[model samples]
Target: MNWNDLEKHFSSARLGRYRASCGGDEAKAATAYVNNMLLSEAMMPMLNVLEIALKNGIHRQLSTLYRRADWWEAWAGNPAFAWQTKEVVSAKAKLQRREETATTDKIVAELTFGFWSSLFNGSFQSVLWKDLRLVFPRCPKHQRQRHAISSALNQVRDLRNRVFHHEQLLWLTPSLLDLHTKGTEVIGWLDPKLVPWLARYDRLPASWDAFQPV
Candidate 1:
């Protein structure tokens, strides 16, 4: 959606005209602004998950990363890390990995695997490969396995974080409204009875209450 159209869909939401730096990266200011807004759409669910996790003793884990969550983070590779993972006290291993995220492919691989593994249980390969691997179809033959997933996940994470932070959604680009609407499925997960609110946000998909993240 164009800026005006985006403003129309989201009342009171405005694109940050003046460039605002995120993590001191001036080049990413504009995209970061729009992403900041769009990502908020994910918050209702992420926060719901946070609540569920909190009620189930997960909030204790958030205060200070001690387990897998804090174990394998790549500090400089992600901008939102500034906000989300900054509290994590790095150990010798991660600091070494941090030093290698860009230098050695092996380091990037392990760090990438660790990052997603922390997000979800079980092995990290499937989730990372499925969501991030295919993003760079044209990557050089060998580089595809190593760089593509990391690069795609990083870029997507930045955009996702921008939206998560509620900065701005539609900036000055084109987005698949169909895909955007699919977010209602997520709402369904949070509240199986939120069809009305989903419709209010124009996120209710055709199947409606049939499935979450529909």
Candidate 2:
């Protein structure tokens, strides 16, 4: 496609916005850079590991708090807790569709990243975080507030959804890279092994240089 046609697909107003932040008036360069970052094999695995760590990490904490592995049925299954029940049912449906044996770990693995991320939302914020805090052993040592972690996770969730939906992130450039870093750190807090594994193949460390203005 010609430059004008390409620009139409990406939108000139959006390109202008990126130019304000990134400098230069090269819409083609900006669009190419954004497309490259989107197509790169970095963020997806990081998000995958992140979602796994979140569900597993949170499941561990919840199990301890409720003193049972099947805590979801007791804690989330009720008329008063219908939202949580819906999330659980959705997770189970995913588990069943895959034709794999259903277990707590597998069910947690099948759960959407949104499910774990939503634990910090308005519905569960007041009570959930207290139990959830114990899993992030490093957070307290660094004196990082629970609310900060909640906000960071929510940010990752937003970024994850945007990327998966093929939306614009180039305008977010510097701050977008910061969110990727936050994602890895959050994964580390949950599972130390996952950090090194994710970093081994991660391209963002090098990929980010292209996003900065010359």
Candidate 3:
């Protein structure tokens, strides 16, 4: 029970009430907004993905095979689709959510990760990479690592699994900056672009690569 082992960065965050501002700095604002959206933003999408999924999944779909009145359906019908917790209702609901969301996660990985990581060969973030590309389309391109990106996304999916499973994520050092990158740990796959996003809104330092992976 050593209190010294714990280092906390999250202050109490009210649901959706958490906010940061870049004031009048548009450059700063875009970067911050994207970073928050990627991590926390993914949660919202995960909910829609699950909801739409529960309505549309094949084996588990709310069609002729299963209806909204079934126990499995009741399980999926719970309200806490995005939250991870120990309450029986939420835990069961989350499992249902993941069962549906995992497939789409795979789809996103295939579409974005390799192309995304190629933008950061020697350490730059997608935050700047994406915008910079938009600003400077002729910039030399980085080769895509299809397998690596796919693999990374798989890891990220596992993190998703843990959250939906309602397991204690206290040990998790999470940064929701990328929906496509993955590795053994979360930060290892974070894009530098996330830093600019964080900086834009949260006023973090320029060194986003410093966020160590656990």
Q: lDDT, candidate 1, residue 208? A: 23
For residue 175, model 3's alpha carbon misses the true position, in angstroms, by 11
lDDT of 2 by residue, 10-41 (tens): 77775555555545556655665465455444
Q: How many clashing residue pairs appear in each of the predictions shown? A: 17, 0, 10
| Candidate 2, residue 11: lDDT | 79
Question: What TM-score would every model get versus the actual structure?
Answer: 0.27, 0.75, 0.23
lDDT of 1 by residue, 75-141 (tens): 5566534432433333336756667443323433333222432432223345334433333333455
> Could you list the CA RMSD of all candidates, in the order they appear?
14.9, 3.7, 17.0
What count of clashes does model 2 give?
0
Writing each residue's lDDT as its tens digit, candidate 3 over 1-214 gives: 1111211222223111222233444444334434443343334343333223222222232223334323233334444321211233344455566774423334232222223233233343422333323322222244223344334445555655554643322224554333322221223122334323333343112223322222
Best by lDDT: 2
Q: On lDDT, who's better, 1 or 2?
A: 2
Model 1 stretches with alpha carbons more than 4 Å out: 1-39, 42-87, 90-144, 172-214
| lDDT (C-alpha, whole model) for all candidates | 0.38, 0.72, 0.33
